[model samples]
Target: MELLQLQYFLVVARLEHVTEAARSLHVTQSSLSKTIGRLEEDLGVPLFDRVGRKLRLNEYGNKFLHRAERALFELEQGKQELRDLSSPEQGTLELAVTAASALPHILREFRKKRPHVQFHVQMLATQEMVKLLHQGDVDVCLSSPAVEEEDIECQVVYNDPILVAVPKGHRLAERTSVSLTELKDESFIGVKRGYGTRDLADRICKSVGFEPKYVYEGDEPARLSALVEAEIGIAFIPSTARNSRDQIQYLQVENHELVREIALLWHKRRYISQTALEFREVVADYFKPLT
Candidate 1:
């Protein structure tokens, strides 16, 4: 009926001698005899046949012995697994990140601190990251803000300044910084709608008092850089989107209020695992200066 009672019954069942079980169990023989009596009384069955001083298991007690042993073993194993999860030795940590946010520093530090954690990471857009988190496809995500939704928690990692990706021979390349108004006359290449880049592009155009005359729209960096090289148009992106060997050059926007905030996103229903929390602390410490 109770685990303690079952445990006492099991010890007596194994030894088949009340005195021997009591000695092994470190209890007085009278206390062990009384405990066995209580177990039998609670179960409404005589577990052992008492012949003189010897104890022998009845059929029901023999049948229940294996099941009781399995229950206790499983309980001990369950506790061990929980302890392993907290030990920082091994685990699967699933996460997603924005297509381009400079998180190499944080990732390097995380790997150094937790080498045993297997990381599953993907490059995704802000909206895509939100979708994955909601569907429970990932434990966490790094993203730029796009679609505002409920039940999704976001923490700002840092702000990345937007830089214009221009053709090397473009006239504005000589300028230290240029306003969005200066780009109204230039053909602007931009990311598609619903993406953070697209929103910022629209905001810049709006501030400069004219919408962009786009010649191309997509989310690929290499191809966009190639397009800029071919003299198609110029585009704006966060600094992380640069390709060092590309013919396109990144330019600063002076007196510009535009900035992209990189954030860590998670579902409200999901509890951050110990490894995830540790990595979060690492990122926070790494990016504190940028915030």
Candidate 2:
């Protein structure tokens, strides 16, 4: 019934381990167990199925988890709204980004305008970003293949064209454009599969009837350029991340509309702080020229 009880139960439901969850919650295991028991008693149903030291969310717990999350989300929004009212000029913006290439420019421009404002940036995969946004963990998300959840507001900020990057001496480097089918046999360097760009590239390649053979899969987009430059493999890269140095050549994707729609997403009903609004404006301004 108590807020603390709900909070504790949610944590236990997530971890599914009493000792681990209690350690993370910074409470004694017995105390955490007692709290969860009280919450289950209040609800008149057992939330979790117990097996020795481990716990698993039962059907009831799975159903209640969503409600608990929403309750906490609303409470957090209320707190943020009050904080924004008290300190309109200074606040931390929780930003999650899947489009890592564009983030530096956006943050730089935003910092120039609001030096007093701060940022907590998370480089997250598309699914993780969406999950956090729904949970109210992030204020906003810059994502690709925009999130389509009914409760989330997603607006396209930039239509970033995807291109193929190759080392200077590579045959594709001389071509101004190449089709996805042409790169079928080429060894590739790519970001990991979870990344927006990587997923998009895979889908586009699949559409053309082949999957790219990644010689090296990495986490950093910046490293893709380096890998291509070393002739380890060619890569599908966003136009915004095209390297200026002649060592790498960026070729347009011919016969396909290979573009990632970079989007800004936030919960439509969540309270938006003045600083967050300003930050959104900054993001819009930064991507305007690129679009």
Candidate 3:
């Protein structure tokens, strides 16, 4: 019945491993187990089903978890609201993004306007960004993939075209544009499968009747450009990724609608502080002219 018990149970339910959950909670395994046992006794029902050393949430636990998560989320939002009310200008803004390509400009403008506001930024995968947004861990997310959750508000900040990048002396460097089919025999350097750009590139390639053959798969989008510069492989780079690097050529994809939409997302129900609201405004204004 205690708040600590609910917190511990939520962690255990998420990890499904008592030892790992106890470690994460910074408590002894026996203490965590005893607390869970007491919680079950007080509820008059077992919340978890024992599966070897792992704990799986039972039907009752599954039903309770949703409410438990909401309770914590509400408490956190209330805390943030109080902090905002007390010191509107000075607070931390938790932000997550898929990549850092568009961050410097946006953050620079935001910081210039709200110099007292601090920022905690995380470069997360598309799925991780969505997960944090749902958990109320992040105030906002800047991502390429459009989030379609009902509880979330997603606004398209920028629509950047995806360009095929090649080395300066490569055969395709002189071309202004080329079709996806033309690169069927070309090797590519791409972000891993879970990345938004990588997924888009894969889908577009599949639509053209051939899967892209990758010479390397990595998590860093910046490294993909470096690989292309080294003549290792060509890559699909976003327009935002364009910089002063002269070693590479970015060509448009011919007859293909290959574009990535950068979205600014926030939880609709979560309390938004003045600082967060200003940050959102800064982002909107930053992209206003681009649209």
lDDT of 1 by residue, 1-291 (tens): 677777787788888987889998999999888888888788788878899769888797887788887676566546645855677578667888764545676788899999888888887667677788876678778777634568887788777778888887899766657877778788977777766766877876787699888889876544677788788998887776677845677888877777887777777755567777787788778778756
Tens-digit lDDT string for candidate 2 (22-112) = 9999999999999999999999999999998799999999999999988987898899988988987788899988887878888888888
**Candidate topping lDDT:** 3
Listed per model in order, the count of residue pairs whose N, CA or C atoms clash below 3 Å is 0, 0, 0
Q: Report the C-alpha lDDT of model 3 over 1-291, residue by residue, as the tens digit.
A: 898889999999999999999899999999999999999999999999998769999999999899999898788888888988998768889999885687899999998988988799998888898999987889988888878889999988889899999999999889989999999999999888878888998998999899999989987787887788889999999988877789988899999899988888998998987887888898889878878
> Each candidate's TM vs. the true structure?
0.63, 0.87, 0.87
Q: What is the lDDT of residue 130 in candidate 3?
A: 93
Question: What is the clash count of model 2?
Answer: 0
lDDT values of the candidates? Answer: 0.76, 0.88, 0.89
Where does candidate 3 stray beyond 4 Å? 15-21, 29-63
lDDT of 3: 0.89
- Better structure of 2 and 3 per lDDT: 3
